[model samples]
Target: MNCEHAKGLLPALLDTALPADETREIETHVAACEHCTRELAALRKAAHLVKELPEIEPPPFFAKKIMAEVRAASVPKLSLLKRILFPLHIKLPLEALAAVLVAVIAIQIYRTVGPESLRPSDMDPPRAPEKAQSREVAAKKVEIEVGPYQSRTPVVSEAERPQARDEQMRAAVDKAGPRRAPVSKDSDKKGFAAPPPAKKAPPAPDELSKTSLVLEKKAKQSDVETPRASAGAGAAGFEGPRYKKPEEEKASKPRELHSDEIGFTESPPPAPARTVEAERPAPRKLEAAPAEPAPPPPAGLARETGADMALDRPWLDESKKAGAEEKAEAEERPRAKSAFSAPAASAPPQVVTVRVDERPRAGEKLLELLPSVGARLTRKQVRFDRDVYFVEIASKNLVALVGKLKELGTVGKASVDTAGDETVIELRVEILGRPQ
Candidate 1:
């Protein structure tokens, strides 16, 4: 074979992988060429040196350790079924028992004491007093008998009097006119029985307008007048500082607190008709409304709100300003270029022509390659397109012939045809090398 063929064979022979034909070629070349003979000798010597180099020594104890371990006692063997069931036999029953115990305890606890335990007790028995209650009942009876036009306060012994008198006094203060409010002395009794004439509530200045509007409507109705005789009896019953009058204004005292520390005796509830109805109805809406409003927040809530506002204001204001600035920028700023830039309009139909001097088409030069490589030409296929041709050629010589074809410009791509024992290859050609 040739020098290139010989070089290829030499590498294979050195690797000991050369086939028979290639091996014979290598041997023949080595025999005739002194240069090849020297190269082979040097290659052999290098390989020998590599093989002769001192072998790596393993650690001294490595072999002993490996042998000792391999000869060591074997593991105790169990049947495959026992191995598979071993873990489950120990673990599964314990898991099941734990699960069952947990379920039972959970159920028992749930059935015994439940989530409702977390709720607070809100129930309270009626807290009205029994002593003044009889007196109040007496007052209501007299009020109905007297047509409710006359006051029905009755004289009672000092021992029979309850701090309810203070409640009565406070009721009076609540009904007190623009005049100065009576200073109440339920100071001794924390709760007072509301006596409308005696009931006193602090009139908040702001609610005064609403109070006035309601007060005006109530004013049109008839008020009970004190009878001359009962008034004298009531006046005489008021003995010195002990019978002191109730303040006409309500204080911020908690109902429960007053009862606890102050022994506050709140007024007996107004008798349903004459003595009680008016006082009970008048302040309930206003006082209750304010108290309810405060229920919306805990005492610390206002400070918390103020703190939250303080914390948020800077960021909120900055963001708002930033948004405004961004808006301003958007309005006054230049429009951005489109991100895609319209894909360069498909590169503007750019046509670059390459100089291809010798290109084979459906022409006479193609006839030069026809016979040696074995080609069957179809005259009709070559007739129409100046750049196309058809031929039937064997695939064996296809690569070599195609290599020569490239030197003549390009042979676009070949179309292979199988007919009987022959294969056909068709190709398109371009005559003009540059864009016109």
Candidate 2:
């Protein structure tokens, strides 16, 4: 064997894989050729060194890492189309689902806007000869009745005729229950016409006398039965018609006043005398105090005039008393204070503008320090620009409050412009931060 063939068989000879004849030929070549001998010797030394080395276990997942690297290197660069359609295991199932979705969509589309043949319209069958004959007979009857007018009027079906429409309206009204009475032409004219003059015959003299006697008797009974009340009440708690005695009736005379004397104060109709009181029982005394008595009339006026004054104007005394009381109240009411007078002390709120790196953190710190320094937070305002906290603290504790707040953030100088009587100070702590 040549040196080239011997070199090729050297590794197989080292592993004892070569046949005896080949091994003998390779060894014979190696012995003759210096180059093959050196190559064989070097290979033997490497094999011996490998066998003498300690057997060390490979790292965890060594085989998996190597196989992954081999696979990555073996894979060819994919075109954009191939890359998009990669991962056949998952993509194939997705493609199948897409196909099914498309089929379902196609079915939905077909159902919504399908061809006309899929759903044909129903056509009526031809009428029977007997029915056609009956229709012709009906048409002939219409023609006989409306022969002359039919040319001028539009053709109307039986259902659309005025008589038929009126019948239908009546039927619908009957079905729904009548809402109102149907008004006819005669009734409409009668509704607008003036009614016949009511002929009320004058009552007979006998009936007139009887009615007057009944009314007088009822008036007398009510007057006697009802108790006498305040002066505001008419006569004896009887405001109805008052029957006069025989003397009053004879005394009452109807005197006409001329137009020239219209303004002249005529003597008030003489009050009916208390003859009814003589017939009535004495009235019981009322529990309520009597209303203020009307002022006594002058000596020139008769006693009857005093009764007239009380009956005519009982409200005079009440109105006068109310006016007097109102006048006294007006005099006693305190006058409003002048503008110059120093009113109650109320100090304006002092704003303490505080600049801080973090507003929320500073606010938390301020909240924690408020109670320790004897200050109470009245209101907390969170706005877009800044956070404001209203604090009410005693004037004595203001210094301590400020000192404690300085630890949280930079505190601004606040002027203490409090009123002399103001003991509490309202401090507005405005915490500011850098703009976002």
Candidate 3:
């Protein structure tokens, strides 16, 4: 074997893909040649030396530091509890409720046991503190105490009559000096100031009458408690619950002047008697006569007024004219047709035709085969020119590849041409690729 052949086979010989004959020949050449023998020996020794090279060991702390840093920088493992519950909507309300419950309880406890602070000394004794003062104040308040109204009838002995007289009342009335007008008490037939009429008397108590007399007894009960009350601001209770604010007395007032929305007061004169322009009597419009199949008016006048009768009647007139014309033409057509007769009875019909030539085409089925052969030969892009297709490939022997493609079915004949600068093949194809 030649040195070049032997050298080329050396790698394959080592890989064992070479045929036995080639391997044997290469082995014989290497054995006979001393230079090749020495080269092979050197290659073996180099490979052995590479295999024997020592493994490197980094510094002891290198791995430890790297591992520590990696661990420190690594993402933490998510808590399974959080992972399981985070995205669920159900847990949100539960967690919110729990948090709210805790907050409410905490607030309640705080309010229940919060510090007891003293209020300002100037404020009324805290919380109805002065029971005595409060009772006094309350007692002074004008309260209409309702007792269990016990109903009863009064009895009087008829003999006690003439005691009721204006003179008897005048003495009592005058005695009670120019004080407040006192409602007089009632008197019986015997009068004698009728025991200051029982709690309540029917038949209208004789108050301020000739038969009645008002008592002069003077009693100072609660100063605030008075039978007659004045509609003044002083009556509203003071020192009520902290939440009850003092009453606000807004005196109702009557507005006297008109004001604009902007708060500017303008004494505007009454809108000048609106001489409402007597609505110009909506210009009377001339009414047209109603239509009841009336004969159409002259075209000129109707057209001037754009009357539908004149415009519409023409269509009917045109239809009637067309009918008359059609009838006259129809009556004349048969006579006209009868005057013309065919000269012959039978004859072959003449025909005119032009011929066209359509070239046979290679269908998609055959075009697909071109790609397979072209791909096997490492072909890339292919271009078409009329009946010829040019294929660009990476390898030679493209002719042989084209021959293999011819085995596939085709609608037309083809020939491969491989004369080109680069590895290119030309094919006489009738079909080219189509847009998908």
The estimated TM-scores of all candidates read 0.25, 0.21, 0.19
User: Which pairs clash (backbone N, Cα, C closer than 3 Å) in model 3?
Assistant: 160-189, 160-190, 161-189, 185-213
Candidate 3 C-alpha lDDT tens digits along 257-376: 000100110111111111100000000000011121221121112222322222223333443465544343332222221111011102111111111122123333434555665532
* Cα lDDT, all candidates: 0.33, 0.40, 0.28
Which segments of candidate 2 are over 4 A away from where they belong? Answer: 1-347, 418-422, 434-436
Q: In candidate 1, what are the lDDT values of residues 204-317, reduced to their tens digit?
A: 112334334334323311122222213221322222211221111122232111112111112232221111101111111111112232421221122123322232233234
Question: Which candidate number has the best lDDT?
Answer: 2
Model 1 scores a C-alpha lDDT of: 0.33
lDDT of 1 at 204: 19
Q: lDDT by residue for model 2 over 1-436, one digit each (tens)?
A: 7777678889876877978987888888888899988998899999999999999999999999999998777665444457666787568888899999999998876654342113111111121222222222322322332232322111122101212212222333343112112212212233321111011112211234434433443444345335422312222221111211111221111101111111111211221211111110000000000121311111102112332223212222332345544333221110100000011112123567788898898988898888886777755656555787767666577777777777877887665543332244456788888533
Clashes of 2: 0
| Candidate 2: residue pairs that collide | none
Stretches of model 1 off by over 4 angstroms after superposition: 63-189, 193-436
- Comparison by TM-score, 1 against 2, better one: 1
RMSD to native for every prediction?
42.4, 37.3, 50.5
Summed backbone clashes in each candidate are: 41, 0, 4
Q: Name the runs in model 3 displaced over 4 angstroms.
A: 11-22, 61-66, 76-436
